[model samples]
Target: MSDHEVVDEKPEVESTPKTTETATEAPEDTTAATPKPEGNDGGEESGDDMPPLEDIKYDDETDDAVKKKRIVIPEDKPKPKPAEDGWLDVLDNGELRKFVLTPGAVGQPRPERGCIVAIKLVVKLEETQAVVESESHELTDMIVGDSDLFQGLDLIIPLMDQKEVARVVVSSRFAYGKTGIPGAIPPDASLDCELHLLSVQWLDEEFVLPIVDRIRIGNRKKERGNFWFGRQEYSTCIQCYKSAIKLLDATDEELESLDTNELKEHFDQQMKGEKKSPEDEERVKELVDIRGVTYNNLAMAQMKIDDFSGALTSVEAVLVTQPNNVKALFRKGRILAEKGELEDAIKVLKTGLTLEPDNKAIAQELNKYSAKRKKELVTERDLYKRMLQTDKSSPPTTPSKGLWGRSSVTGLGVECNC
Candidate 1:
């Protein structure tokens, strides 16, 4: 009956446990706190949008299975093709390749045989830029590529026309191989060549017959060494002379110091029974003559090798037999010139020229010596003049000032008044 009047009866209902309000302090302003990069936990932060760490799943359960990968990428563009179908290819292949004989190519359907070529070439080692050999020759005979010729040479001869030039690469198989030239090429070395073709001549059957005969005869007479039958038999003489030279080549200074007279005596002993009949005697004389000639030739070889003293010895041996031999006299004079014995050189050269008046070489040498003598005389005269001029020069001297400013008269000298 009094629901509206209950408000006064409830002791204010304990004010419903009034609790005090606590402010959250705006959550400690967490944005101002140490901010972390995105996707970061309190642990290690993999800042990548997708972290590298992932669960690797493999179908193979084996413990030692290796991981495999397959990747694809772009490649470079293709290169241009080389000029591989010309005479260069023929040379490389050691034969002519596919080529059509056309008027446009060779100006004739068929190139003529018996053709000659004038050529120039520079030969160099493949591994270096240094030139090994060079030649410029006006050759009158060159045949093109065929099975009959050296394959490398065959390939190139046909490619060139008159005045055409080319660079050729020669392999070791086509050039000098192992055991190269004594002082020139190395073993198994390839060569680079630049060739200039100056001219060509077509060879006909008649023009080629002589070479064919030579080749056939050379082939047929392989076993027969160089023996001129029915001619003056100089074989014995040639053999002895060659043997002597060979011995000389094998000797050193120790052997050379042996008495030459004793060597000659030994030679005579060896040659005692050589002349058994009149013919034998004649051969022996020829042999001796050839031996003398051989000695002279050896001397010339020695001169070429720059062994001047050895050359003099050889020339002396020759001169013992033929004193008036102009060649020996001229060679001796040249040796003297090399030794710087100018007076002796002039004397010998003059003697040789008198013997051989047509010897232009000796005349030239004499002229050189005369000019040199004149130059030396002029040099000496100039030096003498310089010495006399030096002697005529006067040196400066100080004048005495009346003996320390006091003029005194002495009995030893007379004084002049001032």
Candidate 2:
């Protein structure tokens, strides 16, 4: 306590002068600060108030930074306008519209030029929706690009696929032009058409081969023909079978040149070299058999349509390869019978019965023909006998001149005297 008191007394007296000297220096410092730039003063004031630069974080991944960093942008994006329920602008022009009622089969075949298409359609006025012409229940078949359809339909149907349903609107230019549909569609009237594409089929060989293996394609045609035949659609059945026959190349030249013995020999050689499978031989045989069957089927369909001459030709074609085919022989006989060639019909039926003696159908047909022939012979014999008998019973009519030069009944009573 004694030492602190002595030191405090001496220091306090000296410190008072030092403080006055520092106070005098402060005025000089203030005068120098006043001359400093105003910008520097503001900078210092801001720096003093703000947090340290190192302490504050700056985001490197903000949206603004990312936007500035991007370089590429796409141009001309397509934006489709929403259409009304069941309606769409197919061409993005008001002139052509499509309203889908029922979706079609996926990946179905569309009609192409030279293809045959079948459809059910209904035509109406676009403004009034009044029915004009309709084919609703039955399918109308047309050969694409060749048939006489409405100009609008010709352009539009080829764009449809099988089993598809839609209503299409067409402007006057695409429809029946200035002429319009007389007594039905008015002049320059926009048409609303309901369409159902039932089928698309190509009859051209070159077009079909690329889509399916030749044999399988022919088989499918054969099956379709049989289906139509079962439904008694003879015309359609004949067309289908003809298409199948064409695909098989069952021509006179081809059939004549096809030698199964040669085919078997070649197949045997290939088999010996292990280059051919048993299926190859089987396929060859099957192709030959299919050709014969197709001919027979064609003949049957022809018969149903009363195409007797055509049926005969087809049956003869079958018999060329399979002379003993029961069905071919029966069909040939039936066709001959229809042509009134009874003798030839009997001969054919007898030949068929020789091959298949147990076939009741052939036997029955033969018996019926035999009975008919006997009846005809009997009837003719009776007719001839009756004619002779009648001639014998009836007196001959003649005008005899008497002495008076007048017609007299000479055979009455005076015949004995004469």
Candidate 3:
């Protein structure tokens, strides 16, 4: 419940109560607490497997009463199955379950985190099977990564396809929870919802999409890169990361659209003296975070195949988005050293060390590159000094062989005139 984003505590649709926010990043953390807004870059950890079915239990029939009603299956009759066809048991103890009413597109891919999806939900309180009151226009679309819905939906959406429709029932832990919506949802109320997956767009035609959606898609790509990296497929990992950065890359024109000044100033301020709805600055932070993570992943993949130049470029991009990213600084240092730019490498590693004085990786790399540079400098200096010591007017001379075809030399170890 803490991991997914749920609908605002006070759902705006007033009638349509928000369920848990879904997108599969684990409950997908919940609370419409992100006020109105909203990286898992690693390979996603699968949730605990759905628990096995429970043995039959007599309802209100104690052990003594069971003897009177002995319910037995005939030996010839097939044993009753624990499961019902077409239903997905989502969590332990039957906290959540789903039955698809309509299958999705044939071979349609499941949405990853950060997708912009169109969905329609018909929600009702489980106890009464009465519709939850909300504004009719609520819950038409969602960003899979942000919590503005119920936690159960977070876990359920990934199992759906484009244009798929399903019925999901979730207990209070995933719905309004113990802290129910006042005057609307009661405490400990379970919810029944019919969800329609209208459509999804991840990469193509992403310009007009919400910033949160773009960031989510970028991070999903980074996670894919991590998967490829673990498989030792450096080239594939690099490609995945490249695509991710492209998603995070916001052009100048995009910035103008985000500026409340030139555009949405009226709507944001018109409602009241206090700004109402639509958080733009928070989205910028999300953008920076995704850019940093994606560029860092890209740099690492390039480094794996000794693509030092490319790695340097990628790491620099991370620094631009996140100047203080220690991992980026470390990577940049290494790439510089590989390119024989030790002085620059040392400077970067030093900057990283300042940020994390206890970081062993940065310390060791800094030492190794610094030592190599020092040795090269000393050798060059000695060659230049020896050249300066030689006389410009000095004539060349030939050496004579002494005993075993070795050159005869004086005490100074130079061939002598004798």
Which candidate wins on lDDT? 3
Clashing pairs in 2: none
Please, what are the lDDT tens digits per residue for candidate 1 over residues 62-82? Answer: 632353322222355443222
List RMSD in Å for every model shown.
Answer: 36.7, 42.4, 22.7
Off by over 4 Å in 1: 1-243, 246-285, 392-418
For candidate 2, the 10 contiguous residues with the lowest summed lDDT are 2-11
| lDDT ranking, best first | 3, 2, 1
Candidate 1 yields a Cα-based lDDT of: 0.48
Q: Name the lDDT value of residue 418 in candidate 3.
A: 44
lDDT of 3 at 406: 74
- Candidate scoring better on lDDT of 1 and 3: 3
Q: What would the per-residue lDDT of candidate 3 be over residues 1-418, giving only the tens digit for each residue?
A: 1111111121032643434433222453444323221122343432334221222234455543232322333255352223668677766468888888998895979886767678888888988988886611234446564443556887788778889999989898877567676677789999988988898868455334455656776676666566556646566567667766766776554344455423254323322344433455555556766777777777767766788888888878777647888888888888888888889889999999999999987898899988899999999999988887785555554566776677765545665544
Q: Count the backbone clashes (under 3 Å) in each candidate.
A: 8, 0, 26
Q: Score each candidate by Cα lDDT.
A: 0.48, 0.65, 0.67
